[model samples]
Target: MTSASLLPSGLRAWAQRQVGPITAVRDVSRLRPGSRVWELSLDGGRPGVFLKAASGVVAYQRESFAYRHAVPALGPQAAPQLVESSARHLALLLTAIPGRPLAALDVPRAARYEAYRQAGVLLGWLHAAGDLRGEHRVEAGEALQCAARGVEKRLTAAGDRVRAAERRLVLRLAGDLLRLGPLPLGFLHGDAWERNLIWSGRTGWVDFSRARFGACVQDFVPMYCTAWAEDPGLRAAVLRGYGRELSSEEEYALMCLSALDAVGCLAWGVPNGDHALVERGRAVLARLEAQAV
Candidate 1:
C-alpha cells in the first residue's frame, strides 16, 4: 500500500471528493516513475476503484467518451464500469474489474488461444456498436487519404531513426494502401494489444486512451506485431471469432499499417529510452522484410 501523502495533492483531494475516504492507495500503472494510475480502497468496505489521470485534455475526453458511449455496449462483463469523471482535473474514476492482463499471464497454448478468441469477439461487438461516419461525415477514401498523409509525415520525421530500406518499405506499403479502394470504417479500440486485454475467468478489455473513429484494420496493427506474429494459429482464431474475413484490400492495409507502426516504435522508442520497444520494432520490420523477399 502506498502512503496517501505520496500521491499528488490535487489527485488525492479530487479522489477523496469523488469517493469519500480512501483507506489505501496502490500504484498499478504499467509505466513507472511518472505513472498516473492508482487503485483505491474505500471506507465502508465499498468496492475498490481505479483512478486514471489523463496526460492531456484530449486523452481525458476521448477515454471518457468511449466509456460513456462505446464501452457500455460490450456489457458489464466485458469492461470496467465508469464511476465518474472530472473534466477539470482530467481524470476518471472507474470500478475495478478483476483479472491480470493476458500479456502478464503464463497459460497453456489452448487457454491462450481461447483468450484471443474472446478478445476478437469483444472487439467485433465494439466495432458493431456504431460508425463515426454519422458524426464526422468524412468519406472513406478521404479519411484513408488523410491517414496515409499522417503516416508519411511520421515516417519522414523518423528520418535516420529508421533504416533507409525500412523507410522505403513503409512508403511502398502506404502507396499500396492508397491505390486500394476505400475501406470500411468503425469505432476502434486503438490500442488492442495483449496488455490491454484482461483475463480472469474470461477476457475483458481495458484502457481506451487511444480509442477513436478510423479504419477498422488500424485496430489490428498492435496485435499483428505481438500475438499474431508469435502464432499464426492465434491470428486465425481471432479472425474466426471476429466472424468475418477481411477483404483483400483490407489485408494490404493491415500490412501497411503494421509497417508504419513498427517504424513508429523505433522513432518514439529511441528518444524515450525504451530499448525493448526499439527491438520489437526491429523484429517486426525484419519479419515483414523477410515475407516481402
Candidate 2:
C-alpha cells in the first residue's frame, strides 16, 4: 500500500509538519506487516526522511518513547534521529540512518565475532545509562512468569512424553531463576539480534518496537539462543567485550531464558509452516534439555 493509503490523516499531517511540504510520500516497502514505513520527498529539496506509521496504539507509544527517551541517552550516533512523534496518530518521523543490516554482511567468521563483541560493548553503554529504570517497567518475576507461560503453551502442543519432559525442565529452571531474588533491572532492546543492527560505516541500532524495562540478562536471550549458539567463538567475543563472565546462577538463568526463546520460536513457526524456524526451535530446545540433564 502507498503511504497515503497506509498512513492515517492525522499521521500524514504530522509528517508534513515535521518535514515541511511533502512533495511526495511513497511506500518504500513494508518492512513488516503492521509497520508502514515510508520514504518522503520534501518540496524544499532537502534530503528525504522516513516515517513509520505503527499499526497499533501501544506499539506507536513504545517506539515513540524509546526514540524520544531511551535511545537518545545512548548517544547521538547510537540510533536514528527522531524528527517528530505523534501520540494521536501513532506515528514517528525519523532521519534515515544509512546501513544494511548486520545479518546481511558477508564478513569472515572473525569479523562477525568482532561485530558481536562491539555490539556487546554498545549494550553495556546503554545499560549504564539507567534511564529506563523508572515507571512502565516489567518486574523480573513478572517477565519470567510471562516467559514460562509462553513455554508451557508451546510445549502443550507436543506429544505427551515430549511435553511432560520439557515442562518439567522448564518449570525447574523457572523456579531456580525466580529464587535468585529480584534480578537487576534495566532497559531491554527486547529483540537484540544481529538483524536489528544497521551496519553502515558505523553501527546503528533500530526498531525499538519491543523495547522495555526488564531483567538485564533477558536482553541476551535472542542472540544467545540463535547466533551465539551457532558459533562458540562469536559467543566468547561477545562475552569478552561485555567485560564479564556470567556467574553460575546467571548462566542457569540464561539457559532458562534461551529455552523460553526457543519455545516462542516454535510457537510462531509451527503454525506458519516456517521449516527453518521450526528446526531451529527444536535444536535449541534439545540443547536446553541436555543442559538440564
Q: What tens digits encode model 2's per-residue C-alpha lDDT throughout 1-293?
A: 54345655676787887778888777755343565777888875698888887779878876787777778765656677788887777778888777778887987776677777877777766555546443545443377666655655666664342466776776677666666755666766777878787666566677787876677778888777778888878778877877777677667678887776666666767776767767877888799877754
Model 2 clashing residue pairs (backbone): none
The 0-to-1 C-alpha lDDT of every candidate, in the order given, reads 0.82, 0.72
| TM-score for candidate 2, residues paired by index | 0.86
Question: Which residue pairs overlap in candidate 1's backbone?
Answer: none
Cα lDDT of model 1 by residue, 1-293, tens digit: 44632667788899999899999988777663334788899999998899998878888988998899889888777888798999988999998777899989899999899988988898888876655655544632365566666776777766788788888888888777678786877777888988899998788999988887778787888888887888999998888888887888888888877787888888788878889888888898898899982
Q: RMSD, each candidate, Å?
A: 2.3, 3.0
Cα error, candidate 1, residue 167 (Å)? 1.7
Provide TM-scores for the models. Answer: 0.92, 0.86
Clash totals for all candidate models? 0, 0
**Residue 111 C-alpha lDDT in model 2:** 68
Best by lDDT: 1
Root mean square deviation (Cα) for candidate 1: 2.3
